[model samples]
Target: MSCDNCETALENLYLFLDEEIDHASIDEIQAHIDSCSSCLTAYDLERVVKALVSRSCAEKAPEPLRERVLYSIRTVQVQITENRGI
Candidate 1:
């Protein structure tokens, strides 16, 4: 595959790894990764990183903490919107 095709494939590498895209796109990215060593290295790194993040985030937050964080975010959003006169 051409470098341009490899470039295009890398653009959606994460989606491919996550199985979030169409089969045709997955096939294209898979083919590109199989053929291009550089892209393959990048794909491997991205896959490893995603796996690490997923495992690290497997724990659920306590309900009270979660609610407080969401409340703080909403409060900030309201202040911002009010300042913007929206």
Candidate 2:
């Protein structure tokens, strides 16, 4: 594995895992991971970590907290609008 390919794959690993990159870039990264054992291992580890994080973060906020946050956001919006005279 060329340093460049491994570097690029590792650098963009997050974007690739999150499906945030363009299709062309995804294809390029996927190809590198498929061909490079080291990158593939890195990719597998990152993927597992990401999945774990996503699962761990899947809990919803408590109802009271959710309501308070929404209220604060709406209050701020109203304040901004009032300040803008709109």
Candidate 3:
């Protein structure tokens, strides 16, 4: 498999990690990462960080905090509407 340049592969690294890129791009990035130790290390680090963040954010906020945030958002919307005369 032909290898992609480090810059291009790293540029799409986040998209690759998030699975947001097309299959062809994924293959290209994978090939680059496989052959390039620097990019492979970077990919591994980012993948771990992403996984950790995802896992950490998996917990739901407490019900009271959620309600308070929603209430604050509604209050802001109302104030904005009043100011705009909408």
Candidate 4:
């Protein structure tokens, strides 16, 4: 079932999955899915990826690695501020 207007493209579909689309766009996508089998399949694949990312990031970061990364960012930020005399 193809959309009559073909308005729902994959990029907008990705934004919807990422919760970056506005409510009206979400409504539009829902309408598109109701009519377009191809876009619906694509949307399903994106949902699977979203769920997988949620699952994978559910685990805690290792302590040393987390601290090291945070420290590096802080170091860089402080250096930048010092350079700018801020």
What local distance difference test score does each model get?
Answer: 0.67, 0.69, 0.69, 0.62
How far residue 63's Cα lies from its native spot in candidate 1, in Å, is 25
Over 1-86, each residue of candidate 2 has an lDDT whose tens digit, in order, gives 13457767877988999989999999999998898766676677666556555665787455675565556545544553454353
lDDT of 1 by residue, 26-73 (tens): 888898789876667667666655655566588755567556555654
Residue clash pairs of candidate 2: none
- Candidate 1: regions farther than 4 A off: 59-86
- Give the residue spans of candidate 4 off by over 4 A: 1-7, 59-86
Model 3 misplaced stretches (Cα beyond 4 Å): 1-4, 59-86
Ranking by lDDT: 3, 2, 1, 4
* Whole-model alpha-carbon lDDT for candidate 2: 0.69
Worst lDDT window (10 residues) for model 2?
77-86
Stretches of model 2 off by over 4 angstroms after superposition: 59-86
Instruction: Give model 2's TM-score versus the native structure.
Output: 0.63
Tell me which of candidates 1 and 4 scores higher on TM-score: 1
lDDT value for model 1 = 0.67
TM-score of each: 0.62, 0.63, 0.62, 0.57
What is residue 19's positional error in candidate 1, in angstroms? 1.4
Clashes of each: 0, 0, 0, 0
Can you write out model 4's per-residue Cα lDDT over 1-86, one digit (the tens) per residue? 22343444555877888889799988887887777655665566557556655665987556775565556545544553444353
Ordered from best to worst TM-score, the candidate numbers read 2, 3, 1, 4
